[model samples]
Target chain A: MRGNRIRGHGLAGYIVLSVFAVPTLFPIYVMLNMAGKDLFQYTLRPLLPTFPYHFENYLYAWQFLARSFFNNLVIIGVSTTIVLLLASMTAYALARHSFPGKRFVFYAILCVLAIPATVIMVPQFMLVVQLGVVNTLFAVMLPYAAHQSLVIIVLYTSFSQLNESMFEAARIDGAGHLRIFTTIVIPLSKPILAAMAIFEVWWLWNDYAWPSLVLSSARLRTVALQLVTFVDGMAIPQPGQEMAANVIAALPIVLLFLFSMKTFISGITSGAVKL
Target chain B: MMDKPQVLAGHRSARRMRDVRIYLLMLPSLVLISLFFYYPAVSGFIYSFTRVTTRGAVWAGLANYQRLLADTRLIASFGNLAQIVVFNVIVVATMPLMAAVLMFRMRNPRAQYAFRLMYVFPMVVPMVVMIIIWRWIYSLDGGLNILLSLVGLESITRAWLGDRQLVLYAIMFVNFPWMGGLNFLIYLSGLQSISEELFDAAIVDGVGPVSRFFLIELPLIRDQIRLLVLLTVIFWLQRFELPLILTDGGPGWASMVPGLRMYHSISRDFNIGYGSAIGTVLFILVFGMTMLQMRLGRRRAAADNR
Candidate 1:
């Protein structure tokens, strides 16, 4: 009797959850369904898939977005590396030591959270212009690397939570700060560091506002900038091709999630919670 | 004995050297942040008080601030923002919290896990792609209209994004159900953190699902609710991406937002001073809200201790 009651509750829960899932997953369904359709098929059946899927939409999208894909790779690669190196080294120092001016250093980075990027965007653009890097990839890369405050805060908490006795043992065996950081700290903190890396890549990959301001040059445009202008750049402006490009743009993060699902989910949850 | 004092001084010097190395480790981050963050923040404030043109910046006193007072487009933008913020903070945010509580109470662990994965999978898609799909959905001859006509609601089907009265709500409706992102994960984790004993005790008392949620889960996740609401407010306050990309604040400035206006000032009009003033006002509002949240958190913390 008790088991039956519990089963009844489960059924209700399943029904409610499925109702919510429909709208959430609807767009993904639409994207896939329409991605292979021609204009004629799309008009005839806008809500469902038609016969004879046109796989060439993927081919055309790949050709259209090939260069922008490479550009995103280079920019995200360089910037994510810069953020990880700078933030981890700094986080290590702050977490392991208790030196003078420590509080000042911590607050200086923490306080950046209060100042939204939207506020300083204009002057930051002027600064880029003043430095004579207006049309260069550095215009986006430098600012993105500077977005290290959240990573630093997250790493600091994880680093401080490490077993202090392990560090002491390393020091006694003649391991210096750099050696300890590389061998002991880095290895143990892989999950957290991976999480932070994924977070950085996710945001930088998806960011359009800052890149749109600086990267007007066609060759330097990030995937996001290219995706927004994807239809415009095409010769014929096929709806199928546009949806195909959306799928292509979304592929990298999806692959990353599939491989590291645990880390990816935990990263987003904790990172935003800390903010 | 004299050599012991000398050795102590040597140890102190080595410690001092390590501290200096710590400073060196921090130098790259400090330099980059100063160049990109601190320097522009200070300059953005200074520019708000001046008139900036192609030639140079000049002192304009309170002129920019005064112009902000009379700018009707700016006022309308804020009005639109208020509607967006209210809908998101109150209505949109609740669904995730409710879903999370139901999942937390479930008897089947495997079913719970599957539902969680389904919600989180869409997050892998770049937000821009989602927005593009939504833009297409709201187009005149789009899927929404097609579906409406199929169901015999053809009279109500029209251009969702192009209509002034419905444009803002359409933008809000992009992620209908709003259960696909960080908010859901945050709430689920908050629910997970609650003690198991409280749930068991509620079950023993034969409390219904509704009563258990109201008395136990809702009050326990107060912190998460507060955080998500503040995040939603701050996000809606500054984000013009939807309007900027979807409509470009168009159909005759129906969806114009301050952030989009600021972008236009710099990119299109070259009116840097006015943009900076808008930025300053937004900064004050964001900073003030953040401070209010901190104060409330402290007060609640103190009361809990008492």
Candidate 2:
């Protein structure tokens, strides 16, 4: 009976799902199709794929967006690395040690999760100005690195659940805090750390509002910031080139998805659930 | 007795000293979070009450709040935000739930995985790319209009983002049939947690599809529903990126939200005090909603424990 139900639902389920999939996948298909067309071809056939594929659109977009890619690489790379290193260490401290005021410290870190970025954005801009880092990549990187609360929280739970005897053995072998952290805790927490890193990278990559505020100079534009500018700032926007740039902007994340599909999905879901 | 208590206190203090190295491990995170997060939060609250200028802040008391009360754009933006938030809450509850249910019920594991990938893979594209495409779709000569003309409905085709009445809905309609991303994943995960035996028993009882959903799936996934609802409310309440990017809260304030107003205050006018006021207001709303969710979550967890 159960098997019958499963088979019964299968056809209808697939049909309904396929119908939904069309709209779900339409924007992406449109992006790739239009990306290969020149303005003339786009005007001629906007919805359907055109022949004599114009790979030059990608070339032109690459030329336009090359700097922003480099900028994003530096900013996201430095910030995510900083966040993971610092957050893991902090999580280790909280998890492994029975420190004085541990509860207070844990609560302090946890409370930052409640403070939405948009809430603090106004005065944070002022703080950035006061520190005199406006229009620099540091303006974006510093805050990104600072907002490591989610990472720290997630790592704390994982680290706390780790086998205490492993640390006890390491300590018996006269391993210092640094030694134990590098050898035992770090190795054990690799999966969680990787997930957190992917989550952070995805977030910082998607982030536009903060980067838009801080990095005003055309030189320091992140891919997201640059993509928006490409559409609006152009004298006469080329639809093909614009879509091509959109693809370029989205390329890293798409590659990330291809490589670590399960991890990418779970990472975002876990991060969001904690929020 | 006093001396004994003092000695015990000293011993505890000594233990704290030995753990000082652990605190040192945490110092960097603490200092950075304070500098970037907490400090600004407190200062933003202060700045909301002061008149911030090029030179410095001046004590303006309730002046910024008074202006905020009288501001027409802010009021309209809040109204717009309400409509958007309501629509999103409904969308969050229905579409993702439907897709997740369908995916969960699929028996072929490979087919299920393929469908899951097909649904989620598109979200990997940065949201801005999708938004920009949607902007084009709503443009005069864009996809929607072209489709309308092709279907002989060109008479009803209007500039989707330009019309005042339609702009908010246009912004809301960006990711149509929004059965993807975090919400869908959360719902699917919730469904997968249900035991196979329970499902088999339900099937043995000859429960119909709709009845199975209402009886088994719906009750079990209530926690996930509550979570997504809370998340949806909080998300739509503060996000103005759609408005800021596409119509720019325009066709004259039709799509404005408080978050966008706060953004303009800083970026366009450097009206820091007024912007801070808006931020403070949004912060209170977001924080209050979050606390309410936590309380309800705690109550539910306690009931589950019982």
Query: What interface RMSD do all candidates show, one decimal each?
Result: 4.3, 4.3
Model 2 chain A poorest ten-residue lDDT run: A1-10
Off by over 4 Å in 1: A1-8, B1-9, B294-306
Give per-residue CA lDDT, model 2, range A1-275, as digits (tens).
12224325567889989999998988888889889999899889998888988999999999999999999999999999999999999999888777568899999998887888877899999999999999998999999999998999899989999997887777657577899899999998888888898999898888888889988889899888888999889998799999999988888999998999878887888887756
Model 2 whole-model lDDT (C-alpha atoms) = 0.87
Error of 1 at B24 (Å): 0.2
* C-alpha lDDT score of every prediction, in listed order: 0.84, 0.87
* Chain B TM-score, all predictions listed: 0.92, 0.93
Q: Give the C-alpha lDDT of model 1.
A: 0.84
- Please list the residue runs of candidate 2 whose C-alpha ends up more than 4 Å from where it truly belongs after superposition: A1-7, B1-17, B300-306
What TM-score, computed on C-alpha atoms, does each candidate reach?
0.95, 0.96
RMSD in Å for model 2? 3.4
